[model samples]
Target: MRIIIVDDEMLARGVMREYLAAHADVEIVAECANGFEAVKAITELEPDLVFLDMQMPKLDGFEVAELAGGKTRFIFATAFDQYALKAFEVHALDYLLKPFSQQRLDQALAHARASLAAGSGQRDAEAAAVSAAARDVAATRVRPAERVLIRDGARVHVIPAEKIEYVEAQDDYVQIHSDGKAYLKNQRMAELEEQLDADKFIRIHRSYLVNIECVARIEQAGKDSHQAVLHDGTRLAISRSGYQRIRAVMQ
Candidate 1:
């Protein structure tokens, strides 16, 4: 299996390479010094596995995984245990604490190989469970968004969901475009759809879901897609399947 080692420290990367070299089935494709480099390498090389480091200069491992979009199985090699819970939350295959033993590294490799063989089935199951649990939590959790919560740096600004014109998917995040500015949230389009009021927001495409209240016009695009022009003049394409659903609601 092709693998990439991502660590800010040169020594960590070297150590991982040495440990992985003992495995005949594993081949080191490249080594990255930071999360941004890791992201670029993963996108271009499309390695089967990644030896990810938790902390890096610019992006960090969590951001890297999010950017990768589950394309590669991640085996986190970190000195810190604090990120273990968050790593699993992202469905990481394994976590190898720093100063790891060859035996421990081997175990992580075994788990990663098994997970790769299962493809995305295990991930899908985990996602389903998470979704179900999130539903339960949402039921009990206080509704913080009478409007919306705009995550600006370390602080969160709550705005009304009704004011949201539309949302666009960017990698693992969704850009919540409202009145004049856009807010970035760590969420998927599908997840946001479930949380938002279905009556007010409608998914117009795989990458976009818009507030029906903010839709100014629907223009024909092609045989299998249509463009929705929002009140803010943002043009979003609607897939044939999504267009049908939107049309059904309108009718």
Candidate 2:
């Protein structure tokens, strides 16, 4: 079996590599320091499994998994207790909590090995179970995003979530407008909508997310159309439902 270890800290990667050295059947294909490298390696190497860290530079573990974890099984290794709960929700093979004992690592590897050999029917059943569990905790786990991370070339931009005036969908990505400047992010608008604080950001249209506090005035554009005017004089299209949402909140 081929494996990769992805963690930002070299020491952490070394610890994982040293622990895995005992498994004779597995070959360590690569060790990555960031999610970007992990994504590239996953695409090129296509390892059988990866030991992914939940927190890393650039993209977080969940984002990387969304972009590249489809073809390979992953056991997330993280110190975050919150992610331990989320790991099961995301259908991870298993998670190795930080400072994991040798026994714990062996158990996780055993689980991964067994699952990898299981039939498609078993995988489908497990996926269904995880999906149901995810639904059960989705409501309770709606933590508002405090900062939005955007990568532009070699530059990493961190935008305060509350500073966002609005978000416009641009193909597969989204354009976030804030304080007279716009930033591009490689993310779906629907995903951002769910992560942003609901009380602050609202889906004013299928293609737009508006910061409720930034609204100067909402005007009827025509019989069936409406527009939201921001503090900086930016006007955004609003759907009927969007207008109703604003009305219900601001009334």
Candidate 3:
């Protein structure tokens, strides 16, 4: 099994590396110090499994898993057991809480081995499970997200929630417009909307979600039709239902 160990802590990496050395069939492909490096390595190496730390600079393990997709299996390692349920919900092979014993690491690896051998039918199911879990995780977040993380290849763009002027849905993706720049993120519009502050962003149309603070005014488009005029002068149509939703928030 080819593996990558990702953690911001040097000692943690060393301990994991040492523990894995006892397994002759396993090969450690890379060690990443942060989530960004982990994403880059995971994309490049396509390892059989990853030992990912939850807390890291740049991106958290959950963000890395979301951005990396469901190709490689993961066994998240974190100090917080609060994430264990979420990790399993996303179909992660397993997770090891911090300061785990060598025996605990072996158990996680055994889980990964079984999962990988379960054939593509099971893999497809796991992928679907992760997709659904991602939406649940977003909607149930303790607080509305303060920022949005977008992965562009190996690069990550962190856009503060307040800077997001609007989001436009394009099929399976949502185009996030912020600071005069547009970023395409592979997420459903409704899912993305759920992650943002509900009080600040309103779905003005099936295709568009706008920041209330960015709206200049609501203008009449035609008889029984209305549109949102943004501070930047861009206009977005508001559906009858959308108009009702926005109107309540606007008032």
Candidate 4:
């Protein structure tokens, strides 16, 4: 399996590279010094697995996983115990504490191999059965809407995603409208779309994205254009191209 190691410490990255190099099945594709570099490398390289450090400057392991969106299996390598709970929240493959032994690394690799095998498919019947099982498990593990980290000036605020009525695009940043107030975040609407759950949120317009639960009614404004009135009395104009996507969920 192709792998990438992400850690702020050079020694940690070197150690992981050395260990992975010895394994015939695993190939060290790249090594990142920080979370930003890791994100860029993962987007370009598309490795099968990533050995990520939990704590880092700018972004942490959980944030990286959120941005990754299941593109690669994440194995968190951390020195702290506080991140153990958060690691599982993102469906990490495994957690490796710092100063880990060769035996522990072998055990983690074995588990990863088993997981990969279980997810593998070739035959039609076998593939269908595995796919069905995976879907069922994923549906069962879905979490309720809760707090979302939003950038408020220099600090980040954890606000409820359900409380958000709609989002408006403002140049490079998106303004999150919620609770009769708007919070400006340094994130693009397109990037935010990937992070949000599709079932709960819908892109109604090029400049607007609304929470489905907040949508009160849809008004036909023109031949192909439509307007969605949110529960908070916010109006969002929908284009002809976006109508089909919103209609499927409305049904």
Candidate 5:
């Protein structure tokens, strides 16, 4: 079996490598220290399995998985327990928490081997089903993010939430508009909506999430639909339901 290990920490990678060296059936094809490298390596190597770390600079494991799709099987090894729910939602082959023992690693590898032998058909089916459900309701209610991360080529941007004018859904990603510029971030609109302070941001349409402070006026487009004019003159479609929701922010 061919495998690739992806993690930001050299120590973590070395430990995993040391443990895997004893396995006769597996060949270590490549190692990546970040999501960008992981994406490139996985695309080129197309290894049978990947050991993915959830938290890394730039793109996280979920974003990498989003970019890679479900072509390669994955076993998550990360220190974070927060992603446990999201990891299972994607129907990953297995998850390994940090500080794992050789025995635990062996158990996860055994599961990966069995899944490989059975074929990827079932995994693909469950992945598609879960992925669809996950995006529809991705995050939970709590403290909203004060700053959001965006990756544009080699440049990583950290935009403050207060400066954001609005967000629009684009395919699987969202375009965050702020300060006369736009940045595309790989995240679900529903998930993002839940993360932003409820009093500051409101969903004005199924495709649009607007910062309440940026809304300049509400224009009646027709009897059934309306438009939300931002301070910069950017007009956004407002659904009937959106019009009602706008009342909270308008006050």
Candidate 6:
């Protein structure tokens, strides 16, 4: 099986290389020192399996998984035990804690082999389930997202949460308005709403999530309906419930 080992530390990579050498069928395609390099390599190489390190400089393993998740299977290796549950929630094939024995590594590799043999139909089903689970986990995570990662083809857009002025729902996708530019991200409006900070962004309509800081004022569009007037002079329709929610926050 072809593989890529990702870790920020050279020593960790060396150890993994040494352990995998016992398996003659295993070929280490590339070793990445950071998550960014890992993403790029995963996108380009399309290795059968990736041994990803969770705590790395810049992007973490979760972010790397978000960007290149569907490309190949992953076995996350991390020093922290706290991330073990989260790793499986994102559908990592296996979690290997650091300082693991060669036997442990072999076990993870065996698991990956079994998963890969489960047939394309099963893999696709698991991939879809993984995506849903990932979104659910992101939504329920305590810390509000500081940034949003959107994968577009081979490119990843790292948009800071504070920079997002508003989010407009378009069917299955959400158009994120930030820094006078808009990005289309394949995510549900309700899920994105939960993922963002509740205190900052508000649902001004069923189809709109607006940053409260960007609102100039709320204007009555009809007798009972209202519209949010943004500082940029953009007006968005607000539903009755949304109006009440925004009013409570604004007051």
What's the CA RMSD of model 4 in angstroms?
9.4
Cα error of candidate 6 at position 16, Å: 0.8
Q: Model 3 over residues 68-181: C-alpha lDDT tens digits?
A: 876778899889898887885556888799999999998988888888889899898887887688667755777888999888987889899999999999999999999999
**How far in Å is the alpha carbon of 5 misplaced in model 3?**
0.4
Q: How many residue pairs in model 2 have overlapping backbones?
A: 0
| C-alpha RMSD between model 2 and the true structure | 3.7
**RMSD per prediction, one decimal?**
9.9, 3.7, 1.6, 9.4, 3.7, 2.0
Ranking by TM-score: 3, 6, 2, 5, 1, 4
**Candidate 5's residue-wise lDDT over 1-251, tens digit each?**
99999999999999999999889999999999998888878888899999999999867887677566557788899998877767755567888999999999999999988888877686677678877766554554357778777756544576899999999999789999999999998888987888799888999899999999999999999978899998899999998899999965686
Q: List the lowest-lDDT window of 10 residues for candidate 3.
A: 133-142
Instruction: Give the C-alpha lDDT of model 4.
Output: 0.76
User: Compared with the true structure, what per-residue lDDT tens digits does model 1 show for residues 1-251?
Assistant: 99999999998888888899899999899899987677778888999999999989867787778667655778899999977766754567788888999999999899888877886787688677755654665565334334544434434455578888889998888999877988888777776777688777888788888888888878888875689887778788898887887887776
Local distance difference test, each candidate? 0.79, 0.85, 0.90, 0.76, 0.86, 0.90
Ranking by lDDT: 6, 3, 5, 2, 1, 4
- Model number with the top TM-score: 3
Q: Measured by TM-score, how close is model 5 to the native structure?
A: 0.76
RMSD from true fold, candidate 1: 9.9
TM-scores for all candidates: the values are 0.58, 0.77, 0.95, 0.54, 0.76, 0.92
Alpha-carbon error at 136 in model 6, in Å? 7.1
**lDDT for model 3, on a 0 to 1 scale?**
0.90
For model 5, state the Cα shift of residue 37 in Å.
2.9
The sequence of per-residue lDDT tens digits that candidate 2 reaches over residues 1-251 is 89999999999999898889899998999999998888778877889889999989888887677667455678999998777767766578998889898789989999989988896777888889987876676657657878887756545566899889899999889999877889998878987887899998989899999999999998989998999998888899989898899888877
Residue 166's lDDT in candidate 1 = 88
